[model samples]
Target: MTKVNVIGAGLAGCEAAWALARYGIGVRLFEMKPKKFSPAHKYGGFAELVCSNSLKAARLESAAGLLKTEMEMLGSLTVPCAKANSVEAGGALAVDRERFSDSVTEKIRNCELIEVIEQEVTELPEGVTIIATGPLTSGALAEEIRKLCGEGLSFYDAAAPIVTYESLDMEKVFFASRYDRGDADYINCPMDKEEYLAFYRALIGAERVQLKDFETHPFSVYEGCMPIEELASRGEDTMRFGPMKPVGITDKRTGRRPYAVVQLRRENREATLFNLVGFQTNLKFGEQKRVFSMIPGLENAEFMRFGVMHRNTFINSPVLLNADFSMREHPDIYFAGQMTGVEGYMESAASGIIAGTAAARRLLGLEPIQLPKDTMTGALCAYISDPFNDGKFQPMGANMGILPDIGERIKDKKEKYGVYARRAVDSLQRELDRIGCNSNS
Candidate 1:
């Protein structure tokens, strides 16, 4: 059997290792915890979620939901682990972080083909390897990656803050997910019109931490979790539509949706920690306390983690790598996760799966699996490898946007999404069959 080395035991790394092992490839998985730690990592756990627990959505009609369905069809462990430790959050799939990581750790350990190496890798080996070290990769290793990718490497990236559950003013907040659907795992802080306006004003005016040479390097904020201050700058109502949207949540005190709402979610299995649902930030520490406290229920909120931004590193995948994530320059090496420019947990895992499978195939003298473009996984690969910057090539998440738009535009959003999803799955099945994979054979 051929040996494949995978760096980083985070979501992407773990998934990559599992996929390769499944293909009968021996995998050496590297995790830099206990031996070394990132600024955001607290636990010595593998695949620790430094951000939110929510894995986007589980609804088949929604883009994220559809992507997850594709992952399941590909035999994803992340999806099953998520289901086992999942906390209901309406249509979305949110997991208990500890349990989720533990589950990933357990699965990898139990796999006979995988060997878990709890050491930080400073350099890549000469043989077939997949780099999935994620965003918080150590400075030394990041530099090594930069050496490999030539000019396309980045460093600074920001993570959102998490709060201690005990710090929340529960009396002023209510436990409810959106639309009162699923488990009431989210804590909502309702704000009347006047209160929301005041909070908005303070947020926009709050001071931000300055970075050295801020002009040369550019940073892009994650869409799902925008910094509160950035949201405020967009417009007073931006929050109302984005994070603070009062659509599905009803304020029991008013018997109606509040003018705005701040959502806090349980971050761990202990329920002792909570995260600001969409409050990723770059505000000064003092500014965070001053501005965030303006919210109705966060008057005395104790923050466990403050949002900090860092530079994101990624190569121009379209120009650098094939669909399998192996570089055109060097077929021996492969890149996965954010470095490959595939954003979000599911997308990252998908990249790992493809890369790992391809590496195994190369080793086993089998052909690489080229996923059908109609599948979410295939669409993502196409997006990354499109090579058409078109004046802008920001990293993209798997969404219906990447899907070839339907010729007949349906008026109903839900029904339209259903049609796209059905077509996508059907196309995927055909491609799988072409690749000699049968659903039940």
Candidate 2:
């Protein structure tokens, strides 16, 4: 049997090693920690989490929760470890950082099929390999990756919040392009002067997530990546002059120009999800929901992803990688974790599980598992690798908006999400059962 080389001992690397080991494949897991650490790392243990401890909501209806559920069904090594080391964080699965890392390290060390190498890999190894080296990939290895995949593109973590198209109040919003020059490609939310002022005030006052030490990497804002709130805070009319400019747009409801307009651009080809144009923000998730909902036609908007601010370096997965996390040109070389453009802790681990298993299946002369698009894990995989997002790819975490619509509308929010979650679980199970992976899982 061929041995798999798993780089980086973070969440994704550990999961990949575990997945490969489960298939009776020996794995050489590498970690630079204890000898060298990325600027974001501190502790000398595997799977060290530098960001928030919370793994998000535990309820199945939520996007994060749905993703975690699918990972567990796929025989995840992180989800169970997370649950065992959890703290009381209300609905979220928060863990003791040190204890969680210790647990992961212990498991990896004890696994007879796995070996840990405590050195930085400056060159890509020959044969099968999975690179889970995270977002803050730096030094010689980053250069090698850059050489392998061309110059990597970066977004500076200034992404805007995305909302479901179904959640928009159609009666209050109109579809139109600026000056009617292009197709009615933008969803226009016209706001009166009073409404605009109120929203502006709320935005400046909304709570923000303070950046962690790792995130505060000389981050500075210019026109391109400025937060909406930062734009608003400049002056009372700054937003109106910038992103909220209502110059060429007319409100169909009033048959006249409005004070200001917020535009929602289609995110995917299906138009199921739309991102706020020029509304990049660093506000906390709850604060974003509260503040952004103030826009006309968005009073009941369901956010699929919140605006986040950080200094992350990720490869353009849509261009270089396949949906299964393998390089298009070189299927044997896989990339996982944040570096592959999947955001959040569990999402990274989920990528590892797929990449690991995909590699394992190939080694065993078996067909790779084709996770259905309806499943959260599958949707995430598809999202990062879809060619439609090639040029404008951004890191996406698990979100219900990325999934296909249920086709039938359910009035209650909880009920709709519940339906989405249930469908995902069912789709995943059917595939696993069909592939006869349930016994090992």
Candidate 3:
């Protein structure tokens, strides 16, 4: 049997290994956990989610959901594991973090075709290999990756804080989606004009954690995950136009549009914990509690996790990788996960599925799978690998805007998204069948 090496045992690495094993290829799965750890990693398990547990929205019309559907069709291991361990967050798929990691770790360990190697991999191993070390990749291995990819790697990403559900004042917060488009999944903390101004003042005035001299780099915000405090400092109304925008939602109590709203998304299935949506921050812990409490419903919020910033490394894939995630310079070497610049959790796993399947097919002497661009996975692959974006490439998460616009101009957003979703599913299914890959398997 052909043997393939998979590095990092994170979400993308696990998916890559699982996909290879599914295709009857032997896998040497390497992990640096238990023996060594990244700054963000705590759980000694494969596929540990270091940040938010929620995998984003679960509806097909959403980009994250569409990418997940494609992963399932591609015989994904992480998506299934996540679904099995899911916690309730209204329309999104949030998992019990520990249990989710445990599930993936158990499956990988029990797979007969996989050999688990728990040690830090400082050097890239010989033979065909897949690197999925993710954004928090550290130490000597990250050095090796930097050498291979040149100067295209980055090292800073931020995550939002989580609060106990009991801490929120229900009277001040109401559950609702924008325009009631989906289920009432998000808890909205509505604010009047005066309240908005006061909260904004506090947020802008909060003390932020100072990075060490060596840690200081020109902070480039990934547009999608902009820190709340940073957004606030942009301008007085910058936040209102961004995450705290209150356009579609009407406060039930007043039956009027709130001047601003802070939305809390469920972080687990039990609905016991909720994270402030789009509230990623780098404020000092005490300052976070002091300033964040200024929001209407969170005056006494019991914070479970305070927002923190960390370095997230990624390669400039557009110049180095093929659409299938194989290195253009060395076809035998593949990269997956956030390291490949596919930003979201499921997007990383989806890339792993592609890279693993592609690697397996090459080892088996089969033709490469050319995914249709209409599919969410295909669009992401195209986005990351297109050399046109070489100089301007930033980490991209799954979003409908990345997909090709529908030929007909449909004014209704939901209907247009529905069409895009249906088209992607059909296209992906056809391609999978043509390649003799069983989506259900």
Query: Can you list the residue pairs that collide in candidate 1?
Result: 154-313, 155-311, 156-310, 156-311, 157-310, 157-311, 158-309, 158-310
lDDT of 3 by residue, 205-224 (tens): 88888754333454555777
Residue 421 of candidate 1: its Cα lDDT?
Answer: 93
**Estimated TM-score for each candidate:** 0.68, 0.95, 0.70
Q: By the TM-score metric, which is better: model 2 or model 3? A: 2
Off by over 4 Å in 2: 212-214, 439-441
Q: What lDDT does model 1 reach?
A: 0.79
The best candidate in terms of lDDT: 2
Task: Sort every candidate by lDDT, greatest first.
Answer: 2, 3, 1
Alpha carbon lDDT at 201, candidate 1 = 84
Candidate 2 structure quality by residue, lDDT tens digits, 1-441: 568999999999999999999999999998998999888798999999887788898999989999999999998999999999999999898999999999999999999999899999999998899999988775788888888888654647588999999999999999998899979999999999899889988988998888776676575666787899888988999988898899899999998999999999999877899999999999999999999999999999988888888888888888899989999998889999999989899999999999999999999998789999999999999999899997778888898889999999899889999999999999999999888896345
Report the alpha-carbon TM-score of model 3 versus the true structure: 0.70
Q: Model 2, 408: alpha-carbon shift in Å?
A: 0.7
Which runs in model 1 stand beyond 4 Å of their true positions?
155-310, 438-441
Ranking by TM-score: 2, 3, 1
